[model samples]
Target chain A: MLKNITLGQYFPGNSLIHRIDARFKLILTALFIAMVFCAKTPAGYGLIAAFLIFVVADSRIPPRLILKSLRSILIFIVFTAVLNVFFTKGETVLFSWRFLTVSREGIVFAVSMVLRIVFLIVGTSMLTYTTSPILLTDAIEALFSPLKKLRFPVHELAMMMSIALRFIPTLIEETDKIMSAQKSRGADFESGNLFRRVKSFIPLLIPLFVSAFRRADELATAMESRCYRGGDGRTRYRVMRSAARDWVALGAAAALTAGVVVLRIFGL
Target chain B: MEILRAEHITHIYSPKTPFEQKALDDVSFSVSPGELVGVIGHTGSGKSTLISHFNGLLRPTSGKVFVEGEDIWAQPKQIRRFRFRVGLVFQFPEYQLFEETVEKDIAFGPKNMGLSAEETAERVREAARSVGLDESLLEKSPFELSGGQKRRVAIAGVIAMRPRLLVLDEPAAGLDPRGRDEIFDTVRAYLASGENAAVVVSHSMDDVARTASRIVVLDRGRVALEGSPAEVFSHRDVIESTGLRLPFVTRVMHRLRDRGFAADVSVRDLDEAADALLRLKGGGGRA
Candidate 1:
């Protein structure tokens, strides 16, 4: 059951989108999110929706999956939209009930807020879906490269982050095996009252922690054996460079931003 | 007389997902009381899935597990008790050790059974002695133990529950030849007691041949062969089809028989093979 939980997991592929620089996709996703928020009119929102659909279709990733990842947070989205629709002080009262009044401006604000959240998640997911996690970490290090000038310990921070991300799947696999082992020994994790439920976690947690530390020790020894000194003078195997397609893609994004601005200014 | 019965059990992992696997498909088998059955299969042949269903660790997709003629799933609330009745020591169970001391760790299963402290302690000692763990070592942390010792402690943890039906999945995995012998000896001792039955799931044909009275071969979650060790070993063609080989001792006897020597191909254990050879030649020469 735990193994099936693949929310936001990267799928390996060799499409053009997957081949693009991870750094480029990260920046583009950020720009796309900003553009979605800047849009207000119906046509602008429609374009943002179309852009998300286009990206998903182009990447050959099913849109339903991107939506499926949002399943757990559906309540949060609904809560936010409902809170905005009712609490925001607006002028145009479209309808009035006993204790609830629906305002046109409030509805618009709610719709835009919901759209902003939807686009934010979908747009960010593109960076993850198209790029492998290792490439994504490398891009993050490159993005934070300037922080090294201020002696921000960028190497160590990024290394930790990358290790953490790398171990998520491995730890998940370990947890599955441990859970099964515990269950076989009659570690009753599924039943009982509140106290019993909490008590049930002892078997799972202790062994998991033990193996996690053991794995960490082994990994550190392996790294040391490989002579893995930190990023003092590391040279790159794959250097990031701006390509023709990359430049064209960035320029197209800038043009789209300008178009959205023009449309907003003209109230289209 | 069926102690544990799995009726037409089918199981699928990650159902409907891209990574979905039909682990077991309509597999059915039963073990009678006082029987030591060896379950043999490849790594992903659904052997683990089949064992897990015996105690309701996993419910089959379309079948039933009846322990003593009562469906294990009939009263889901009593599943924990069912677990005590049919103890499952998972593959490489050393990964599940948690308590501060070896004694406490070994007592985990019986403690879960809600046994009194004195009773749990006695069971723990019995289990520890059965697995050859010394009294002094029982006070040490499991983390302070060697790999084989920790694995033995883990096995003891399950054994302390004094289950009527004990199931061990690859209990000898990661152990050296000596450690493997110790585990097989302990299992044989448990069976020799006559009140307890066991199911040993293993990939090593030698281990199964030495310890099990009856043998069961699983391929893709279905029972490919089921009978006494001699009966099952006779189906060499079907066993090879599942990508399993006969034990070296069995093969040696088969080769001898094929060479027109007066030898019995029905022997499963090395001792029996040696005895049969000695009967034919009247000497204990290492052939």
Candidate 2:
């Protein structure tokens, strides 16, 4: 059941979006998020939505997977939407029952809020879905390399991040194995009072933590045996280089942000 | 009467996902009282998945599992009870040990069953004895124990429950020859009561050939071959095709047979092979 976590999952494809430089994609994603927040009018949202749809299609990732990513946050979206619909005070009342009010403006606010959150998640997920974790971390290290001049451990941080990302699936598999082992011993993780259910996880957690520590210790030894010394003077096998497509993608993102800012200034 | 049975069990992992796989397919297996069944398979032959169903750790996608004549999943709420009835010692069980003391680790299974404190302690002692763990070591922390001792403690934890059917997955893996023999001996002794049965899952045919009354060879999630050790090992071609080999002595005997000598090709272990060779030497030259 732990395998259902689809966050940060990457789909490999030779599409135009996948071919874009990882660093540029990261910057473009940040720009898109800022532009999404800048969108205030319906026309602004429409423009950003159209851009996102086009990017999603070009990414060549299956639509079903993108929809699946949205499912994880469906509850949060609905909760916020409900809160906005019932609590926001507005001039044009659409429905009223006792203290709970659903006004025309409230409905519009709820829709806009939902759209903003959806765009934010979809846009960020697009970045992850297109770029591999290793490339993403490489881009992060590249973007933050200037911090090294301020005595920051940029390479060390990147190494730790890549290692953590590498072990997610391994740790997940270990968790599943330990859960099954404990379950065979008649440890019930399902169907109990809240305290009882939580208490059951003690057996599961203790073993998981033990195994994780053992694995980390072994990994450290293996790295040391190979003369790994904290990413000092490390040479890249695949150096990051931006191409014409990457520059065009960044230009489009800049243009979209400019358009949204213009729309906000005009109050359109 | 059969102690455990799986009828046409089929299991699919991560169904409908890109990583979807059919781990087991239309496999029927059963173990009777006083029987030791060996399930032999190479890696990814569905040996682990098949045994998981015997104790209701996993529900088959399209089949049924019966523990002592009752469908285990019939009352989903009571599946834990079935787990207690069918004790499973997972692969490399040493890594599963977590209790502070060896004694407490052994008692974990029985305590979960809600046994009285005295009963649980008594069972712990018996299990420790069965696995050859000393009472003096019980008070010591499990983490302080050696690898083999920790493995024994983990096995004793399941044995403390005294399940009617005990299933061990690759119990002898990653052990020296003596350690492997000790584990098999403990498994054999567990069946001395005549009321309990056990299933040993292993990729090594030699580990199970001597003790298993019957062997089931799994290949790509299907039961490729099933019979007594002598009966199954006789089909050398089929066993090899499944990515498994015959017991070492059996292969030797087969070699002798191929060289025009009258040797018992069914001999499973070294001692049996020695006796067959001695008899052949006494019987003049070739058959």
Q: Count the backbone clashes (under 3 Å) in each candidate.
A: 0, 0
Per-residue accuracy of model 2 over A85-178 as CA lDDT, tens digit each? 9999999998899999999989999999999999999999999999999999999999999999998999999989999998999989898998
lDDT of 1 by residue, B1-287 (tens): 78889889999887886778899999988887778999999888988889889988887888999998899998888787888888888877888988899988998888878889999999999999999999999999999999999888988888888887889999888889999999988888887877778999998888888778888899877889988888998888899899999999878887887777867778767778878988878753334
DockQ for each candidate?
0.68, 0.74
For residues A52-131, write the lDDT of model 1, one tens digit per residue: 77778878877677878777678989999998888777899988778787798889999888888888877887888888
Best by DockQ: 2
Candidate 2 residue-wise lDDT at A112: 98
**List of chain B TM-scores, one per candidate:** 0.92, 0.98
Best by lDDT: 2
* Clashing pairs in model 2, backbone N/Cα/C closer than 3 A: none
